[model samples]
Target: MHLDPAIDGFARYLATERGFSVNTVRAYCADLCGLATFAEERAVGTVDGLTLELLRDWLWEGTQAGLARATIARRSASARGFTAWLTRDGVLPSDPAVRLRSPKPGRTLPRVINRTQMQDLLDKLEVAASTGDPGAVRNLAIIELLYASALRVSELVGLDVGDVDLSRLTVRVTGKGDNERVVPFGVPAQTAIVRYLQAARPALAAADPGATRSGTKPSGSALFLGSHRQRLGVRAVYRLVAALLESMPGTGPAGPHALRHTAATHLLDGGADLRAVQEMLGHASLGTTQIYTHVSAERLQQSYRLAHPRA
Candidate 1:
């Protein structure tokens, strides 16, 4: 089959069969689009025309262009998945990417804001929220709940009013694979959420009626709403989190996930159980949540060096 239609079919398979998220599907689509362009240049227009050698050369070109090892690695994975799928579907006689490999990206420790920094950041937001601006109030609630619950940005935005049980100080979020988990937050988050629901949410929901570009009805059930009264976009959350973390000392990503990392690390530092942290984080594997242990160790070493008089 032609590469274009084959790529489309692969995307649907990812969404339906693999249950991949929209962002994952989009990333795969983009990476495969690059492969498609490269294949076109080589006059390899069909799925069967793609060779392992071409795949390697495309990754090599990415490396030559100084793309990060992580990016190249992701591209390699995308190509491997595409070829394997095509082979399984009988479009290709064999998987061309069977032996394809890319350089493994180095594991960088996640950035975690210490408790003091987190407090100061939240304090600043609280002061801003004192102005009673709906967005500012919502922002405080967002960061509070994010730190308190360690929620993924998608999960945070996907929340509905009914999902949160303010009386119980817990929220039900549909995480990856549409799995639901009820995560608990602290008293601060509970208070902020109550305030937002009572004072800010209604005001935000009653925002401009003409802002219907997202095709979502204004004043929808989304827990977080933008000025348009529609569910807040992921980009808005990213922009807010990125701006907040920009001034922090960090070598890694400064996205909403950083707050998650910070939250997990803080929990571990406070002697929270490893398995408990994993469950709270909605991690399927205990191994995935162990990274926060490393962060805690590093922080402990830093504190020891700073406080201990011995060389």
Candidate 2:
């Protein structure tokens, strides 16, 4: 089969058979598409024309063009998976990527907000929410739940009204791979959520008349709605977080994931178990969770350097 058609088939397989998330499938397809373009430039457009040399040359070209190690590593993985699938499906006689290798990406510690900064930020939000502005109230609830639950923005925005258990202070989060887990939150988050639901949500929902005209409830079951009274999107949440963190001291991304990192690190600093943090993070590998341990150790060293008299 042609490489383009083969990539399309692989994408379908990833979505239907492998149960990969939409973003994962999209990323895989994007990498394959880039590979396909490169192959076409070399007049090797069919799957049969794909060889190990071509794959290596492609990665080499990416490195020469100054692509980050992480990007090159991801591309290598994408190619390996594609060729393996092709081999299994009889599209290729053998996997060309079996011998492929890429440089390992260096692991950087995630950025975390200090306890004092996080508290100050939350206090400011609380003051804004007290004015009874629906947007301010909803924003406060969003940040609280994000910090409390350590949820990915995707999971946070995907939440439905029925997913939250206010009485138990737990939220039913559908994480990556459609895995469902009930995560507990603190009283502050619970209070913020309750306030949003009671006052803010209704006000926002009333702004959308289309749903009512169509004989459906405004905002439907979405736990968080946009100003348009539709389910909130990931990009909106990213913008919200970025704006809030703009003036704050931080060296990494200012997205909602920063809150997740802060929450996990804070939990570890407070003596939470590693395995429990892993579970809360929905990380399949313990090694991923162990990175936070390193973060905590770094913080300890910093404190020791500043406070100890033996410096």
Candidate with the greatest TM-score versus the true structure:
2
Candidate 2 residue 168 Cα shift, in angstroms, is: 1.2
- Per-residue CA lDDT of model 2 for 1-311, tens digit only, reads 88988999999999899888899999999999999999999999899999999999999999999999999999999999999999998888888899999999889999999999999989999999999999999999999999999999999999999999999999999888888888999999999999999999999888847544454345589999877778888999999889889999979989999999999999999999999999998988999999999999999999999999995
The regions of model 2 sitting more than 4 angstroms off are 208-218
Looking at model 1, residue 310 earns an lDDT score of 95
Give the TM-scores of the predictions, in the order they appear: 0.94, 0.96
Report the backbone clash tally of model 1: 0
- lDDT by residue for model 1 (49-78), tens: 888889999999999999999999999999
| CA lDDT scores, all candidates in order | 0.91, 0.93
Local lDDT at 153 for model 2: 96
